[model samples]
Target: MTRTPEIAILGGGIGGLAAAAFLRRTGLPSTIYEQASELREIGAGLVMAPNVARLLRRLGVLEELAHHVVRLEIGWEFRRWQDGTVLSAENLAEACERLYGEHTYTARRSDLLAALRKSVPDDSVRLGKRCVAVIENGDRPALRFDDGEVAEADIVIGADGIHSVVRRVIADSIEATYSGLCAFRTLVPAEHAPEIARRNAHTLWLGPGHHLVHYPISAGKLINLVAIAPAGDYSVESWTARASIEEFLAEFDGWDPRLLDLIRAAETPGRWALLDRTPLRHWSRGPVTLLGDAAHPMFPFFGQGAAQAVEDAAVLAQCLAAQPDDPVNALQNYESLRIPRTTRLQEVSHGRSRINHLPDGPEQQARDKAFSDSDPLVDSAWIYEYDADTVPPFHIDTVAR
Candidate 1:
């Protein structure tokens, strides 16, 4: 007889859905609780790198995601905002295959969510059941919902987001800081976008204290544009699920005309206050643990947020499945294995702005020259090439769902 874990996952977002699917694959009985009544798409588009694409492929959903997303020919295409000068380019297709053994993708968040949701067991996810708190019972965890309903599971996994309630309840000590950057994100039809941005590439334009990244998502039909401005200038919270392009355009009053054009093209955009938390010293307590943004919320600069979460799900399942009788050790080992690595990524993401904030002048000119002449990607092998299931030192503890 196979030993399976009775699991409860909070949040029906990508992390929760992916966790449920992977758990099912491991013969573990699990269910996910979401505050919303329906699993709806949130946000504009996301760049799902190879590390994430490989995981989705493992779950038999990459091809499905591809049908709805645009596969980038290049991983990153850095340029100058003043004059669209190509500084450097990283070939993701070859790099992803060489490193992670899969293709990278950029797609609408809704489309990817749909693909993951398809893999979820029917009625396994209880929508609109807001999780109020998690009470630990040494080796078993019980969850209390906002609707006066309660549930128990052998293990409680918090796939909730940065403001995760379970993360606060179990490992209630991790501190989150508002990244002084508020990102205004939107998706525009390629026809509505500038002719120059219709290709399948991650295009970035660096300006003074601010930058913008644009890419073709949904097979080049929709152009996903993101503008990162210093939060000091804006006085509001992140995307509130409703914002107009007109609102986003005001921020670029003196920006490049081309950039302004692209921003104007995106009909309405959703925005978010970029919040990040240091990697927790402990991810699991007793029979409870945290996953994804709820555990270590990293900056979006490297685009590793979702990828890291997916890796966490896979690793957690592997650890628990290996030692059924000792789930605590399994959870402990998972936390030990994952914390150091994710902490490193979180630290790296903290200093990640330097590369993008390339100071202009002789130094920036030299930087651009070097990037243009030599492949910067040669140095990024450690990042884009990691496998989800392979137990690298960094992943001895972390897993994706």
Candidate 2:
């Protein structure tokens, strides 16, 4: 009889935690190694689209997430910048449930992390163990940590973020190209926001070379905001850099009064350069594999970054559980199933950046008119309806080729 593979997950971010939790559910043990002293999320808010919410429900964290999220009913409302005119809208609750069997939601990043962490076994996560390298050792691979300790596992999952150290173990190098854009993120108290802004809604204010996205989070007590614009004279990639309120406000000068009010009301805003990698051709080799941003880093225009990572965890666990006798083939199956879909998503998101940031012109006018005439739900149905748990069985024949 073949032995079950001992799994090691690098990173404790959402992807790594979800991977560990799902693996445990399949009776496969996985240890998560996070570089941070404690497993905490530094980011702000993200949407859990119906596709992801359904998976979280299956992973047993939907109830916990529900406690922290504002269940969104009306999906997305695209608005023209100057007058806050409605450009288009998506029926998130009714259409989503009718087609996808679930509702969408937005939540604080910490809450999502906490929920996934709670689902994982306490002893399974080892914090502060930064992986510097992964080296081949016979059938198993050994991970070298920054603390001068080496550990070996039958399988190593690189769930680390875009600049993953484990990615070096698979490919020699990869460059994360910047989008020449940066985003300012902050949270606003519901009491502080204007009445119109306080509604339980997801709004996008689009303008020339800039856009603003804000929605309620933390059970509707606070509002999460992200202002994206061209990165001129600022190119740092870290997410914790502080930005002056004046600089943030300057980008939206002469725009809608309500939108400007929210920017001015922000107490402290953090800025990060948007960087992404082209979809990789391969995500696994031998006993090593990549997951989440490490596998496919995408632009945030689609708001599916975290959702895709969570989906990766579910599909990966399913593949491994279905093929315990062959970890190598199982890893290949996971890559094949994910690459095409994720690659298409990457392309679509990049296209949105151009569409959302277009200068006032014929092209921009046509795009807005199209949105006004049609529901975005129809355009995004495939993504909303995707159920990774119920995906067709991955064929090993393709992997054996």
Candidate 3:
């Protein structure tokens, strides 16, 4: 415990940067390797529930992102797709804050990345390094970059995302599968959005075989739209793929006209296949471990993808800090603490598709009635109250070889 080990984090996205920031908070310095030439994020919105809000505040990420965030008073509005009628709503700003001690907020992904990047040391992130494979280096694990550069660290954290090379090394070779859905995303300026869409709330329209979610971000100056439709067998999962506005419109042909106006206002939108991976029985092997999507990639139904990743970073940093002398044991303990929670989340996120995309029949009527009858905040309160900082640490005994 006298000297900190050299920690290397792969992938410079939200999970990677957050891992660096969290480790730095615990006096553990780490280097982040990003495949991109520069540190940047795709234009998108991210929602942070109270569970992650406390961690972000502790890590100083919330303070840095305060200027760019839209604090949500009304959390979620589940609406009917045909008439845009409210199915259920959760009042988060007041109720959730009172219960969980933190309010939910939404911000652009770029803003979050910017804040997390600032917390990390300026020289900690190495750009233009694409990790090809994990190589053995006598006693330490080495990373082989696509550009033929090799780097070794005392410990490696794979935050490389769903297509992670590190996952191939640690997991059971479980492949990511398409979820028979595609999402078209766009950011509409506040001026372009209709009055109904200008509300400071997150709205979700659920219907047969499709759903739409939009929320205010960029401090209420922009609205982020994500329209998901059944894609059947089409399986290209690139985030930068462009889809015609006509194609987007055709998918929601029968939805509310007001919602159509929001879609029409987008100049251009990007589309990507919705994909997920089966939860692994293990997420760590000795000093090498996986974080974020690299460990568990889930459908977006629960909106916990990034939140869970942030949670993982906090827990992993704490576990390592607790067992500074035996990092392999620390990683095993981390995996033990995280796998159950993340596995449940993956199952719940996948299960939501059945609930959100039901046909208008007896079952759909019963579901809508149930939604209208109960508050979403109370139903899913467990998700917002988890605090990774105070999670009971695992009892470490034997170290992994």
Candidate 4:
């Protein structure tokens, strides 16, 4: 009989916590090591698309998340930047539930994190432990932290973000290429926002070299806004970085007056540079593997970052539980099933950056026409219908157990 392997997950973000929660469901508990002193997420908004909603339901946190989220009756509403002409809109409340068996929702990033954190045991998380290096020591890989604490585990999963320490252990270091774009993110009290901004819809205004997206979150009490434009000289890549409202408005100088009014109502907007990294061909080495942004970081055009991380957590837990003793093989299986899907998403998201920022011309007109004709829910069926809990293990029969 094989013994259950000891698992150590780095980073206490959504991916890490979700991994722990899923593993617990399989009767395997893991520890999460986070760099920060507390487990919390920055103030931001994320689309809880059907794909993620399905997985969150399995984890039993979707109900708790529902309390803090705004269920979008309409989503992906595209409009012309200059005149606010409606290009396309999706009836998400009806179509999303009927087709995908889940409703599309939006919520504050912190609320989502808190919901995931609640599913994980408090003792499973170790705060203020910044991992500096990962050392391979035969079957037991060890993590070396900045505080000089060394710990070993039968398997180590890197749930850390883009700058993952464990990722360097398995893959060659690759420099991230700047996408030459930065985003201004802000939240407005729903009472102060424009009527359109307060609507239960996800709206995007597309134009030359930039685009802005906004939707109501926090159960319609707050409006979250994100505007992507040329980076210029700004290169900071932090969620907490500050930008004045004047700077934020300058980026969308000639946009519709309603959007400008919404921007003017923003308080303490955060600006961060958008960076893209080349996707890795492999994410597993020995007993260590990468998950979430550590494995495949992409542009936020698809709003699928958090969703992909949750998918990674669910699939990783499934693979590990299927082969508790042979952790290396299980890690490889996790990579095989995840890397291809995530790579496709990465490429598609990068391509969307160009589509969303096309200058006014025949090409942009054609793009708008395509949007008007295609239904987003139908087009994204492949993504929304995936169930991580039931996805077949990659080449499970071929691997010797």
Count of residue pairs whose backbone atoms collide, per candidate: 19, 0, 0, 0
Using alpha carbons, what is the TM-score of model 1? 0.91
In the predicted model 2, the residue pairs found to clash are none
lDDT of 2 by residue, 1-401 (tens): 18878899999999999999889888999999999999998888999988899989987898887678888876679999998998877767677778778888899999999999999989999999988889998668999998999999999999998888888877768777768889899988888887767776788989999999999899988889998899987778877898998999999998999988888777699998887677789899888999998888888888998999998999899989988878888888988988898999999988888889888999999989988988777778878888888865468476452
Tens-place lDDT digits, model 3, residues 276-328: 67789999887899999999988888789899999999999998888877788
What's model 2's TM-score? Answer: 0.97
Query: Which digits, one per residue and each the tens of the lDDT, describe model 4 over residues 1-401?
Result: 17778899999988899899999998998999999999898858999898999889888888888778999998889999998999999988789989988998899988989999989888888999999999999899999999999999999999999788988988888998878999999899999999999999999999999999999999999999998999998889888899999998888999899999999988889998999899999899888999999999888898999999999999998898888878888888888899889999999999999999999999999999999999987988888888888887656553532
Best by lDDT: 4
Off by over 4 Å in 2: none
- Residue-level lDDT of model 1, residues 176-271, one tens digit each, is 566777788888889988877887788888766677888888878899888776776444544465566777877666766878888877877876
Question: Lowest summed-lDDT stretch of 10 residues in model 3?
Answer: 392-401
lDDT of each: 0.78, 0.87, 0.87, 0.90
The per-residue C-alpha lDDT of model 1 at residue 368 equals 75
Clash number for model 3?
Answer: 0
Stretches of model 4 off by over 4 angstroms after superposition = 397-401
Candidate that beats the other on lDDT, 1 or 2, i.e. the better one: 2
**RMSD value for candidate 2:** 1.3
Residue pairs with backbone overlap in model 4: none
